[model samples]
Every structure is written in C-alpha cells, then in structure tokens.
Target chain A: MRVENYSFVFAVFFANVFAWNPTPQVIEEQVPQTAFAQLLDFQNAARPEYNAYLSAGIIYLPLPSQSALLTEWGTHNGFAFRQRIGIWLTDNFDGKGSKGITFGLGWFGERQGWDNEDFLFVPNRGNFSQINQIHSWGLTIADSSKHWLFGGGLQYLNAKDESFRWWLLGTWSRFSIMPNFHKGDLQFINAQLFLQARELLGNENSWQNYLPDLEFSFYTKDSVKIFVSQNIFKQKYYLEGAFWARPQDFAYAALKFYPDPSRLLLALEATATKKDNDDIYFGGGITLPFLRVAYNHADDYESFFKSRGIWIVEIRLAIGSSGDSFFALKAPKAAPKEVKRIPMKKANFNSNNGE
Target chain B: MKSVKFLFLLLLGAFFSSCTHWLIDTETRIQVKNSTNRDIYELSVISPGKRIVLVPDTLKVDESSNVHVISWVGKFKFAIFVKNLPDSVYLGEYELKGGSIKAEIKGEDMALKMVLK
Candidate 1:
C-alpha cells in the first residue's frame, strides 16, 4: 500500500511538472507576454490573487489539553505535517476589454500521532495516528478595467472524513473609489460563505448541522492588507482579524521570506459561546516568498484569561510553477461561456420498465 | 458486582439513547495489473451504500502499466436494517468495468467484483 501510494504521488508530481512546463507548442502560441503583464498588474493592485508554490510544515500543540468539559466530545492536541501544491491557469486577457478566469486544485494530507497508552475516552478508542486528507479546487473570474476588477466563484472541499465536506462561495471586487485614497491602487472587498453538510457520513441521527463562515479583506496599500473572518460552526462563533504585509515582492517562494523581504503579520481571534469555553487567540508570523510560519496562543477568558497552554503553528508553501495559467486568459466579452452542459436522456427508464 | 452490572446497563442505555456508535477504522488497498497488451485503462471503486463515497472516484493508468494501487482510509458501519450479524462482514471486491465497479460487505472484509462493460 505504501509503495502504491508513493507511486501515485510520483505520478501526480510528474503530471504536474509536465503541465507546468511551457512546451514549444505553448510558447509559439505567444501566451506569456500578456499573461505576465496582467499578473504584475494584479499584484500591484493589492488584491488576493493565486500563485504557485510547494509548502510542507508541521503543526504542534506543545501542550496537553482537551475540551471534554466544554463539549461532550472534542479533538485532542497533536502534531501533524501538511504539504500542498498549487498552480494557476490563466495569466491575462486583452486589457480592459479582456476577461480572464483563474482556476486551480490543491491536495493536502496530514498525519497525527497518538498516545497508544491513553485510555479510551472517545467513542473511537485505540485508533491512533489519525490520517486526514483533503482535496480542494478554486476558481476566480475578473474583468480588468486597468483599475477595477470583480468576480466570484465556488470552492469545493472534500476530506477523508465525511463530516468535512463543505463548499465556499467567494466574491471580490477591487476598484478605485477616489483619487485621494492612496491612488486607490488597491481597494477591494471580499465576501465568502461556507456551507457544511450535515450527517455526511452514515450517522443519520447526529445533531450536527450545516455551518456558515464569512470573511472580508481590504487592501489599504500595496504592501499591507487587513482582513476579518467569522467562522460559525459547532454552535460556536469565532471572529478573527489580521493584518498582513509583504515587504518584498521578488522573493523566491510564496510564503517564506527572504533575508531582507521578511515582514511581520499579526492576527487576533476570539471564540465565544454561551458556555464557559470562550477563547482568545493571538498569533504572529513572518511571511516570506515561499513559506509562512506563525505561532499562536489561545487564552481562555472564562478561566480569567488563563493560559490554555495551547499553541498553534501554521506553515504554508507553494510547490509548482509560480505562475501557470489554468483558465481562459480572456473572459467572454459577451456572456459567460458554458464549459459543459449535461443533456437529459433515457428519461423515466425505470418507470417505463416498471409497467 | 451488582452495582457494576447496574452501571454497565445504565451506560449502555445512555450510549443507545444518544445514538452514538463506535467508529471502526477500515482500510482497503487494491492493485490492478494490466494483463492485456495495452493498458487496462483507469480503475474506479464504487460503494454500494449511499453513505459510502469513494475518497477518489477516478484513477488513471499509463500504457503498459502493470500495477495501479488505490487505498481508502475511513470508518464503516453496518446497515441499520441488518440483524443477527456475525462478528464481522466482508465487502465485495470490484474492478472497473467500462466505468463502474460493485462492492459488498461480507463479514469484516469487503469483497469486490470487477467487470469491464
């Protein structure tokens, strides 16, 4: 099994590399000039755009804690490593009249180590080393006015755990509202809605319900952006606000900082509920070109802000071609082009046979 | 001893009332050998139950590729209507036929039946 899984990984890696390479066929088509220029424009606009990078990092709890008291069941603290690869599909359209769309897919897997000696407190006892895998796809569309951009799309997420299936719809627009607003070079608002399916597994009687999450990001400058996200799930509410800065644009990686291009990012999140398990998390991380690593601490306010001794570290990387266009370079000038249309056939075959 | 028995019964009742069941960790791995001169093509594993969905539905095989292996890690529960069960049940084995595969659980093992329609 291990050999097979590794072979599959190798196959996927080769396929991605093949896809990233700009063949002579592709180069002769003269695809990069306009796409590259558009990429630079989007970067300068201070909007959240997609880029390629490979990242592998580990998250450790560094503390022993459980939320059994707050909830009848909760996940335990552990350490896991995650690796993700992403690619871009489209680079540019034909100036303000050119419509462009970007799409990409990412796969991530994490393995958690467990203490085999621990007693069975949860329903699934003796199940050590939980392994979780997730696959995600995202799409973005925009019409560039050389100053304004707007579009939205849906992101589908499926994880090894059936309970993890969810969808997020996101819309964002960047426009210059006024000339005095820092040249309005990059002012954008984004909204995202996350939908979680209930009882996705076989548990038909579970109390779980769909959850909704929302977030907004605003780029105040070419180097700085502010965002606020609300995650409403598990009947609890979590609000987070963060400020991110990119001091160096020509770094070699996506999330990792170069020696001189490193910047400090700070985030504060508060989780509240009617129960006494409210928590506040303060985190800060350094952002580089290829990787981002951050340290977070959670404080339980109900416990008089007592330190939960919980720490979270997140590291993200980009693995593939830093810039590979996945979608059409130009958005349709008229109506959106339909990629696929399903035709209905063999209607009522079962009914016809029943007679 | 009497108190322990009473406690066990109470715990069992609580478990049943809460509709909570144990999560059984199951893992399956299958390897496809391309016996034909050409590649046997892609392979897919389908589950019989609506609650069961393959972690990955489509897998690609290269030309002359001898072995293509796929693995799934998850929990499986017996159907609610099944009664008088043995210690375990086996799910059937399946191979890609055209584009579909069939699977069933027979005890603790899954038996897969494959065809290329």
Candidate 2:
C-alpha cells in the first residue's frame, strides 16, 4: 500500500487516530499523487487558515448555513484535476451566530491518469496505463463550546470499492486531537499491505491498527501553531505506504498577518516533511472577503501532475453578522474618526484695525 | 475602576493558566456484587494502573456497590478478604477489555472463577 498526501501543512492539525507500525524497508515507493484533501485544505490556495475551531482542514463550529468550494489543476509527472464542495449545516440562516447543531458535509473527487509503473509494483509486470480516480465524502458534526469543539463523523473512501472510516475531532483551548477508528475490510487490507511490504523489504515489522490515527496541536499567540499528524491516504485499490506520516509530523510555524482577527493581509507558513530527507514546504495565502489565493509546494503536486505550486484557489463565504465566529476574517473595524478643528485666528495685541 | 480592571486581569490569567485541566477527568465504573454467602470484609480490584477498593468495610452478604475501575490489558487481579481467611485471596491475572469483569469465588475455600462480562 502506498501512503498518500502527507504533504499538507494544514492537514496535520485535524489528522486522525492511528495505532500500528508498518514494516520497515518497504519497496521504494512510487512518487505520490495529489487529491481533493489538498484543495479543500483552504491553505492550499492561501497562506494561512485562521479559524481556531476548525481542525483537520475542516470546520467543526456551529455555523450559519455556509458553502465553500475549491477546485484546482496542478502538474506532476502528469496533470491532476480535483474539486471539493462543503456545506456547513445550521438551523438559523438569519445570520446571527452561525451556530446550530453544527455539522458539515464535503464531497471530493480527483481525476487523472498514470502508468502502473509510476504508482504501483505488480508481481507480474505489465505495460498498462490506468485512469487514476478518487472519490470520497465526509460528514462531520461537532459540539461547540466557547473554546472547544468535539465531534465524530463517517468518511467514505472511494477505493476499488467504497471503504468507510469513523473519525473523531476535538479542540480544547489551543489543543486539538482527532482519532480514526478502522474496522471491517480496512484492517484486512492493512494486513495485506503489511505482508506485501514485508515481502518486498526483508527485515520489516508487519503491523495493523486496531485503534485510531492521531493529530495533535499546540496553538499559540499570533497564529503560531504546531501540528503533529498521521493521515493514511487510501488510493483506489491499495493503501500506499509511502504516504505514511514519517519520521516527524509537525508544522513548526503558521503565521497570519492581520491587525486583529479580521481582514487578514497575508498568511505565511513553513512545514518540514516527514520523510528521511528534509523537504521544506513554504506556502502563503491572502484572504479577501469571500476569495482566497495561495501558493504551496507539495512534493506530490510537483511529481505527479508536473504542475506548479500556485494554482490552488478557493472562494469561502460565511454569510452572517456574528463577527469572527463562522468567519475567519471579521469585517475591519471602522476607521477611527480623524480629529478636525478649525484654526482660530490669532489675536494680535496690536490689531490692524484699532483694538 | 483601576482595581476592578486589575482584578479582572488576574482572574483571566488564573482561568487560562489551568485551562488544560478544566474538564473533569471522565471515567468508567462497574458494580461489584457480593454473591457469596458470607459477609465480605473488603474487596480490591488491582490493575496495572489502579488499585480500587470496591468495598471498604464489611459488605453485607447480598449487597452490591458501584465502583470506579480501570482495566488494563493484563496483570489485573481481584483480591478478596472474607471473615475466615487469614489473608486476601488473589483472584487472577485476567485480561480485560475494560467496562466490567466478574469474580466468582467459591464460598468455602475461596477458589475463584472470574470472567469478563
């Protein structure tokens, strides 16, 4: 199994539960591919995402009815096209506190083509070109507190057949955790992947998860945060080992530039990769009302699609007056009134006309 | 007004200082039943991480008490000291999947048959 996108700087926070170790010295992995996760991360199109409540590239807060859409095309060995749409559920659309029984739904799809030699190793080698496709959907619901969000959801991973996972997310103060539970065929698939990996690389430990994947964060002042996460990327017919969260899963810095919490001027971030070799990821984004533009360098983005790093774009609008709740950037405070006073004519001891 | 402002800041600081522990330590519990004929002197459940006394004093013959318990993967034992025994009889090194476990002790010799429920 090839591990998928461990490339996102934003996804490390709302990552999932994990408990298992794969065999070491697996076959030299194929260059990775990009998917809908990178596009909807929002940071993929912009520098930084400023919401404290949203974790795992997702929002868990009570929201006024909100809709978000993201689409992108990038170059690697080939070109890849992906799209994502999200609907934040809420009862009151009167635009008060975008707070109801907060839940969200996101649908994502990826379309591209690659040769088996590029992505997989078959026992019997064959020259075959395959249309690599990915389709997945997620449903999340959160219980929101002033400084916390706790919820669980189900995800459908579009593989050879649809595989499902149960994941949970919790954010407290500046700390967040997500645990993913695996059951049914995934465990079996994990075992198969482990055996294949062990066979390919002699001297490797085969392990499977009976528990969750984990993502952790320590949020600090000025939007500087740390994220440690492990996300298992499931491809069409197999689980890729290369995409596993590696040596380390931490984003050292996420900096957003805004006077206060609204009208973010710029967002800047840097993340070190989890692989043995050091690959520094640099990305930044700008938020304008409902529009965002971002530049990011993901290894998969370069290898699979042969695409540049700056084409991820998104438009996110939360229609509500409750400032900074559903929205990351609240309206800028009204400019302070300029002090103006008429200049009084100076009194002269000796006036031109007799005093 | 200045004092008020200072007090407010002080309270905010204290509140945030311990925010990590603000939530209660959530736990799971189990009910211990004394199905044996004799009155129980005491009962303690021993897991790797915890040693909880399910009954502190003389528990009546048929009485039961709800007790907080932590079940580890292994090395989990139940100890019982009854009216006639010289020492507590250790029940098991049982593997637990958490939730609850039952310890059935033969009333006469204190031979125990414990299973997870």
Candidate 3:
C-alpha cells in the first residue's frame, strides 16, 4: 500500500522538476562570479556566529548499540517512516575561542507496513501498524583548542505508550593526530583520533561502553572532500567512507543539468561481525542551500523493505541566520509590498414557517 | 604524589565498574511463570499484525521461561493455549515498568509482577 503511494510521490516530484521555469543552474548563472567568492568569504567569517534553526525531515536509523540492546528484550528491529521535526539553538560561549554549546529538541512518529507474512504471528485483517512515537531532547558542548576538540551530548527520549524509554549520555574527545598538510598540488590530508564513552540508561540497571575511532579526510582545493572513519566499540565495529563535492557555478542560464554528482553525497558503511546480524548501510543525498533530499538503504531492515531492501527518503527545509547567508542574494534589494483585505459585514435573515 | 596516584586508580576502577552495570532501570526483560496444573501447549505474542512464537513450545507445570519482551515504550499482550484446549487463555496485557516482569499463569487468571534486580 505504501509502495503505491511512494510511486505517486516520485511521479509528482519528477513532474515538478521538469516544470520549474528557471532552474537552479539558471539562478546560478545570473549571479556574478565575484558574488560567489564573497559568499564563501562571508560564510567563513560568520562561522562563530550564534544562530537557531528549525527543520523537518524523515529519518530511519537504528538506535546506537546501548539503546538497541532493547532488541534482546524483543523489540522489533525494522525500518519505519519517521515524520520528524527538529529545532536547535547554538551559541559560541567564548567571544573569541572555538567553544560553543548546542541545545536541540526533536519529535517523530513512525509507521510501517507489514506486507511480508513470514514474520507475522497474527496475520489478521487491516493490520497496518505504527511504531512507537518518540520525543527527544539533547544538548552538546564542544571546545576546539590546543590541537584537541572535545564534545559531549546528553539526550533523553520519551516514547509513546511507554513501550520504549532510555537516555543516552556520551562524551567524546578528538585529538588531531595529523594536521592538514600539502602532499601535492591541491592535495591535503587531515587525521584525527576520537575517544568516547557512552552510557545507556535502562529502567533497571545502566551500562556504559567506551569507543575509539579514527577519521581521515582527504580533500582538494576545489572543495571536494573524501573521508573515512573506522570505529570499534562494544557490539559495533564498522568502517565507513563518504565523498562530497561542492556545487559548480554555471555559465549557461538556459540549459540545466539533472543529477549533479559534483554537488551530491554518497556514503557506504559496513559493520564487521561473525553473526548474521552484520549490517551494511548506504546513504546518499543531494544538498542545496536550505534544502535537502536524502535517502538511506539497509540490507537487514525488517519493517518496510524487509529482506528485499529498504529505502528511506527524506525531504527537509532549514532556515538559519548563517546557514543560507552564502546562498542568499549578493545585494539586498527591496520590492514594493502590497496588502489587500475585504471588510467584514454582518447580515440578518428572517424566515416564516407558516407558509 | 602517592595520593594523586591513588585517586587516579580509584577513578579508573569506578569507570570500569559502571561499564559492567548494564541493566539499569530504563531497560527491562520479561518472563513467563506457569503455576497451573495443565501444561501450556503454545504461547504466542500478539502485537497488531505480528505474532511471535516463543520457543520450548511446551511449558510443564510450575515451570518458568525467560521471555524477552523488550518494551522501550509500554505494555503488550500475549495468549497462552493449554494442551488440547479449544480456546486460548488470553493474558490481557503486561508491562515492564522499571525492571524484569513475571507473568504468573495461575489456571485461568494471569497475574503480572515486576522484579527489580
């Protein structure tokens, strides 16, 4: 049933894309070259500014190892459509230093269709179900100084029907094992080691685990970044790699290109384990100034895709002071504003029943 | 210097100890205890469209099986069928509020109790 709906959505999406009058490439070409440079400069200069933002999107990712231990308790591990809304506030505490704190709150409701009867025990009529709705709030503090960066997040979750409940408290510190250096023309490498301790709060007893990870990033002068991370924590050990490239400035206004890989993102991550529970995940996204279209795929997702495969699509719009400053118009231009309203009047009517 | 070393060691020990204390009040498991004279022929978990068959198919009298009913949210229901019984003995619903939950099946009436460990 959901698959049919998804097909209709995709059809509408493509139709709207084709109907766009002046596409993104046309808009890019209208801006002057100098404006692009100014946009990058302004973005770098505003990095430390305080800002707040709100975004809505869909996400289907497994909870971390600790909370996921609920699976041992018989909680279903499956992919569900999550309609999520999130808001965040960030501020640079120190006026001049690289230290800041962020507070965030999010809520999402998830529902999945069970088409496969193999795993169903009831197999009753009209059995489409919804997973637990969750509300979460978190705070993070970070400081990057002396070749070391540290951050910690304390998150709390409340699920509907009290089926699931837990808190995730984690702290991580990163040391710059190798700073960015020029290996060749337009080539650089940066490496970091991250150590973290995550504590999981259950209704009975709490447990904590320590994780150690290494991250390496290779980038060119053209703003294309390729990065990889290797993480080994308790029940999870995975190696992930990603590539992201900056969008190009267009020279032609009339002709537009679809599926721009340069401005797109692709990632592949895998968890290594001897058990059948080993997982491989794929994520991809197309990013614009304040808009994002992303999708994630997993092999072992049980809810919607099940064994065939799972695809989660997300579309979001975000607004912030500095988030879109680089993408906003170069010069501030004002247009005439107009307002129209019709005055309201009351009317009285009389009716006779004798006739 | 000796005091500083002692404190460092104490902190390390505390950290390790906390890591081992995994089952806190937030996560819980469930168990099924049969106190009736008749044996349970089949026990199945019923949630909306899905049903899970608990293993060890038969539960003899006075026998208990550790059933993993992980509830991050709240309560769920199950059904118990006695040997050769035409109808099911429905266990309305049970919740693991803070710790482990035990569903004591006594003849026709099932009682739920929580055990905090």
Candidate that scores best on DockQ? 3
Docking class of 3: incorrect
Off by over 4 Å in 2: A1-78, A93-150, A159-161, A170-176, A184-255, A263-326, A329-355, B1-117
> What's the C-alpha lDDT at position A27 in model 1?
21
Report per-candidate DockQ.
0.01, 0.00, 0.02
The iRMS of the candidates, in order, is 16.1, 24.7, 14.9
lDDT of 2 by residue, B1-117 (tens): 567557556644543232211221112245556667776656676545455565565656767655645322123366777777786767655544333555444454476544445
Clashes of each: 52, 35, 24
How do the predictions measure up, each by TM-score? 0.28, 0.33, 0.28
True contacts kept of 2: 0.00
The predictions' CA RMSDs to the true structure, in order, are: 28.1, 26.9, 23.5
Question: lDDT scores for all predictions?
Answer: 0.27, 0.34, 0.34
Instruction: Name the candidate that leads on TM-score.
Output: 2
Model 3 ranges with Cα > 4 A deviation: A1-54, A59-80, A92-128, A141-154, A158-312, A318-355, B1-117
Minimal lDDT window, size 10, model 2 chain A:
A61-70
Error of 1 at B49 (Å): 31
Q: What does candidate 2's lDDT look like per residue over A230-268, in tens digits?
A: 212210011111232233343233343444322333333
Q: Write the per-residue lDDT of candidate 3 for residues A60-151, one digit (tens) a residue.
A: 32211111211212332222233445444455322333334433222222222211011112322112223323333334333322122222
